[model samples]
Target: MTTYFVGFFLGLHRICDQVMAIKRGNYRKKKVSSTSWKKQLKSWSIRIVVGFFALSIFWVLCLKFINPPITYLMIKRGFQWQSEGKGFKIEKDWLPYDDLSNNLKRAALAGEDAHFMSHNGFDTDAIKQALEKNQSGKPLRGGSTISQQVAKNVFLWPGRSWLRKGLETYFTFLIEIIWSKKRILEVYLNVIEMGQGVYGAEAASHYYFNKSAKSLTKKEAALIIAILPNPRQWDARRPSNYVNSRANNIVRYLSHYEIPD
Candidate 1:
């Protein structure tokens, strides 16, 4: 142990000597100016930050508009005091466009954002309503579209924090400019959390229906859509009477709107 410590100290001393020599050589030679170093650092810093955000945005955009793997709903960390923290595993599964019915689409849209295709990215009217309701001591009206929700779920954390909202807004706009409407719907459907540890349509289908996402029925889809408000609290397969009524309402409302198609 004594010899090991002495050797370790000697190695550290040699490494320090090598670093000092390198610094001395740097001082002796013509070096990059501090201003230039700062500029370069700032440039690289911007590139790193922008690159990270841009790539995440692009991945979301492509996954939304194109047929690809659902990007956001996988659980990385387990639950603490919650219901034993549920997470999902994607093992060669894909949600086909045909498998999801129109009723399900409209129901999801109605449950999430009523005016999905009409707005750009931000739902200012809904935000205003949310704010107004908050002021008036009522329930908040969320104006977030499928894409905005995708942005929040995929890119940003779940919260009512100002910072998270700002970042979500930024990502929402970025994805709107990059992805199409169809892609947004696809991503939202596939990435939504259906239950504890249950994520994506495929995982939820397997957990709830014992089938694939593409084989899901209208009733099954309605049940899934019904629990969108709070997936963790309400089970989709065995929903309560209120959940059934809400699902029925979504189905009824869906008949009036042409959702996803």
Candidate 2:
């Protein structure tokens, strides 16, 4: 009987040793697997960074020559309207820089960004003023320069995110570097939303006044520019008293505003 007990104890000790050896082997394999996963993650991150920079350079170079057929905002609005069964279609007519009315151009500069010709991609003074106003608990006003507007309207969708703002800044810099002031204004005039479906000076003129952009009168141009702050809400054809007042102010500014030659 003592011999039988001794044999049982020896068998139990051997089983425990085998289990511990298996656990140690599994722990080593787990450590190796964790290290491999981290290496793969690092490799993928490097690839993404390289790919992003390559694509950004390509996009900037291509836009220097080609007009964008559609913008992110155009696509977003189209999808939204379609989902709501509004049958809304984007109306755009790409006119050359020469074909656009000079009055329209001046009106835009006066109403939207008076320092369009001088600023790089930002208006520092305007930004400071806007910041001060907002900090004082006043209504927030946009300090975006015409160059920034062109960048956002041409290349980006509407959003108030850090990522979107960062991308906007990058594109703004790229456009300022790659495009001349005339080209920037040309794109801005052609792509900015004028009405619900109207886009560009030519389309806005045709929709609102049944005339060509080149023939828009000074008042017509001012009225068109007046609704730009909220084109979706304000109608140039049926301007509110407030809109008319703003248009008059813009017209007054137009006398002093100079278009770049």
Regions of candidate 2 where Cα sits further than 4 Å from its true position: 1-33, 83-85, 136-141
Q: How does each model score on TM-score?
A: 0.70, 0.83
121-200, model 2: which lDDT tens digit per residue? 88999999888878966555689888888888877888767787888899898888888888888889999989887789
Relative to the unseen true structure, what is the C-alpha lDDT of residue 105 in candidate 1, on a scale of 0 to 100? 72
Local accuracy of candidate 1 as per-residue lDDT tens digits, 120-208: 88778888877876887654447667878888876766667778788888888887888766667776777777776666677787888
Clashes of each: 5, 0
Best lDDT among the predictions, by candidate number: 2
- Residue 71 shift from truth in candidate 2, angstroms: 1.8
Q: Give the clashing residue pairs of candidate 2, or none.
A: none
Best by TM-score: 2
**Model 1 — TM-score against the truth?**
0.70
